[model samples]
Target chain A: MSAPVVELVGLTRTFPGPPPVHALDGVDLVVRAGEYVSVVGPSGSGKSTLLHVLGLLDRPTGGDYLLDGVPTSTTSERHRARLRGGRIGFVFQQFHLLPHRSVLDNVLLATLYSGVPRAERVDRARAALERVGLDHRVDAAPTTLSGGERQRVAVARAVVTGPSLLLADEPTGNLDSVSSAAVMDLFDELHASGLTLVVITHDPVVSARAQRRVRISDGLLAEL
Target chain B: MRRRAAPVALEDVLELAEAETPPPPPPPRRRRWWGRPWRRGDGFDLRDLLAEGVASVGARPGRLALTMLGTVLGIASLVVTVGLAQTAAGQVGRQFDAVAATQVVVRPGSVLTQSGEERATGRLPWDAEERVERLAGVEDAGALAAVDLGGAPVTAVPVNDPSAPAAVSPPVVAASPGLLDAVRGRVVTGRSFDAGHDARADRVVVLGARAAERLGVGRVDRQPTVFLGEVPYTVIGVVDGVQRRTDLLDAVLVPLGTARADLGLAAPEELQVRIEVGAGPLVARQAPVALDPGSDDAFDVEAPPERSRAREAVQADLNATFLALGAVALLVGGLGIANVTLLSVLERRGEIGLRRAVGATRRQVAGQFLVESVVLGLLGGVVGASLGVLVVVGVSVVQAWTPVLDLPTAFGSALLGGLIGLVAGAYPAVKAATVEPITALRGGV
Candidate 1:
């Protein structure tokens, strides 16, 4: 269905040095539409590199990447950016929320690069916040939010554009156990609503919630 | 009346097949020159850029204000210099019109003979005033002679007291009776010599204000006598304020006939003519002809230029000096902007990385920083221009001058500040844009 939302074949990324570090080496992965998948690994296991490559933030040194059956390996930077803006959403471990912006404005910022029409951006952003259970705190600044609420706002921002695939890297890494559990529950609800989700984490509790699990070690991948 | 309603059918309510037609595609949106068509769902909005730019500027108000000081000083100096130059030019013009412009000097030309001796080629006739006065624009005319006394030093006191300070020999000049009016001289005390004194060659003399002070003869009522190379002449008047020949305020003036008769003075050396307003050119042209019809070429007439050329040259030099100073100030301001902007780029690496990760293009990141710098410069420009104009007005008011300011100078300074900001922002914006997202996310190199 939907030609499998994402497919990677023999993807490889290397950091140059006297002895180059192969952060991701010949990794192949595929996720069908609406699937909830977790890529789990310990530190220095290339989980972050895989997530970066998938989100189009970092280029793969070798491999083929397809999103919705469209080849992206040879796409120009401008085209890649357009695809990232319209078709993919990312959540970072740091939340990366702008301190100066209100919770609503942060959500609205998703439409800033997505080309959402000015008239509909506010309503769409509001609806996303509502889905993340943050409608009551729309006008509050991000500094005022608890860790759980901030992460939730970040989630709303990621989904505001209705991106086809959501990529989260260490989504619960900085949150308390209770807040992390709450954020994981929110992820489950979003997945149940038929949105494709990929989470990269070393935490067993976070990985256990995914419908399918994949393990990464020494730049290689295996299914569990 | 009975109305029969059609039975509501679930199939009729569901018209799902008709609903498949996508409601007339959301009204077409406009495209920005820089952005892709809105329907592409991939273009950033201009408003978004502006919002981010404003947010960044507001984030560091104190730093922004400090950075703005440089531009303000630069623009302020430029505007003030231009404004004052205009006002000073206006004052110089009025002074020129009042004195030099209305007065023309006509002097006899000398030719070097084959014998290697200088001889007067054309001498003003004894009736020079009458001839020149006949011209249409001549308001007043008079002849003057230096009346050389053969280098003989004359003193106020007849007794050669060796104990007295060294004798001062002020030059003696002889003038026609109407010279006072032609030269715009005012009688400070007593009276000037009349036609009777000139016709009879009377020994009456008018002491210039400075000359009277030099001779220690302050009052004409006392009838003090000044010995001009051993001939005593009665002091009839003390004159001051000679507008045309200000240097003559230090000379002793006697009747022309008296000087020629007693002091052995030759023919008059110069003809002084005052004309009606705007008659300088006409009188300058016709006066030489009126004085010597055949030897008109032998006389040289000096007329004021139409627009105060000498004063304008002085004004230009003043403006150049002040503008150079302004340029230095502006240069310093531009450097300040560059320094602060570079620092901002370094401090905001985290923000830059975040924006990049959120799908902003490199150009967009560069554009945001550029806009912020430009906004800073524009703000400084506005404040500086306003302050500069106010300073100009304030100084003019204190100096009793009319303020002069043009529109372009006022607005152009602001534009110049903006331009400076633009140039200053270039290196920093490039640095901000080139920071790799992965490195910036790690918060360091």
Candidate 2:
């Protein structure tokens, strides 16, 4: 009976040029509560553009994006950012952890711009690290961690805010097969605990782990 | 039985309901994750920004030190320059205070008292020096008059030779007995004419150093004699270091009685008085009264400045010149900050992208850079001011002067450094804020 966690209709994004390339054209998608969906596509198939629009990092030229039952097209950039920090979380392929901070500080960084209270931020960060099996590495720097452990730290940072939706862009692209499997298993654990997930990857093995899969080619989408 | 059952049922039913209730669905938006209300604009804490500023500044110690050098030089030079100007001014003031301030000159002036006819003027009495010497602060007093020795030129040799270049014509002056002490003159060789010589109307003279030279007289041991228009006078002494009436150094001095009896000298024209420090005004007002009780208005007294206005004037001029130089140096320091900040923004594109992606607004990004620059400037200002004060004290110690520095000027320079940093960082912070997140994520241009 609750509204869908994410809804996009007629989404269009264009890059201004002499030829005027359309990165996304009339894409429609719906993700309900607690669902795990994987968007699979080739290198130039507009997946990044779609992710950018969904993450509120870039606005679509024409479309409707409803996040948590609230239309985000008309919101100010500040309000959109608020929604991004409050309702959604991102895990990038590069892990993007600040090198100067400790693993624990890296996780706590998510609460810096989320309005989290000062007293409880460290405790919440610690609990999130424990969830991702990184409690032992709390004081260690991100540079000291292996690829798999670093990816796990990134996941902890993403879910530290208890967001309604988690978006992972190429989560296992830079990992070995074993590390990839470990990261996927961690995502499975997060999903089993009633968290919504959307993974964007070109790897078939990564897509196969999701409950449902969608494919995109040349800015158009098709259910698989 | 029914009443007892009802009372038992109330407690048991409450306990059963408490156990059956499912914990309320994880409280939504208002209490997201942290279980507290989310207030708008509370995302970034000032403390965090300050911490971030510290971390960024601490990252490259060498670069921070190098950037601070400009401001250090700017502030240090400013303090030293101002301090030295004041010290040098004080040094010049002391010299003036010794001679100009301690000596007072009184001369006769003609006054028209609203009458059509102009009165001749109050002549300095023959005993003017004795009368003025009675005043409290008068250290010594003397009088001098020009003798009208009819048109004949003075010469050391009475017999003129045709080959002589020209006849020397030094004027002759009638001086009182106390002229030596009042004028602070030191007789290099022979003794000066005393009261005994003046009482007997002796034809004695004291040759000034220059006059003695002009007359080919070097030593008073030979009792050199020079002729005043064929009236032979004995040179009793040769005096040097006569500060006031330096023109008298080139003239011959004769006793007042000798000039009066031989050259028809009527009365003294000028009176000179030497007083203690801080007594010029008092002596100036009392000298005329002592000389002629009721005719005080007829004498004009020349006194040095009451306060060291000349020193202040010199200091103000020096301050204006040096402060301009300091401003230029400070401006250069500001530009150095701007240059470093811009380069930092270019180098930290990845960090900027990450922060922007993590919901840091443009203003927040700009604020971080601004705070970093201000911290850099403040550090430089504080260190520079301390070092400047040390340099001033050191120079003062070496020069044997008391160090002078305005505390407010020192503190204002420190704050000005911060202001310079703020202004300098403005453009760079804006440039950093305008960086596109996606482009910056690509690791710069």
lDDT of 1 at B215: 88
- In model 2, what lDDT does residue B391 have? 89
Looking only at chain A, give the TM-score of model 2 against the true structure.
Answer: 0.98
Candidate maximizing lDDT: 1
Instruction: Kindly report which residue pairs in candidate 1 clash with one another.
Output: none
Write one digit per residue (lDDT tens) for candidate 2, span A18-42. 9988999898999988789999999
Candidate 2 residue runs with Cα over 4 Å from true position: A101-105, A126-141, A178-182, A192-194, B1-41, B77-148, B152-170, B174-183, B187-239, B254-309, B315-328, B390-404
Q: What is model 2's C-alpha RMSD?
A: 9.9
lDDT by residue (B208-299, candidate 1, tens digit) is 89988998998878898988878888999999989888767889899998987898877888989888767888888898899989978888
Please, what is the TM-score per model?
A: 0.79, 0.76
lDDT of 1 by residue, A36-109 (tens): 99999889999888888888888999998998788888898777777787778878888878887789888877
Task: Please report, as a residue range, the 10-residue window in candidate 1 chain A with the lowest summed lDDT.
Answer: A186-195
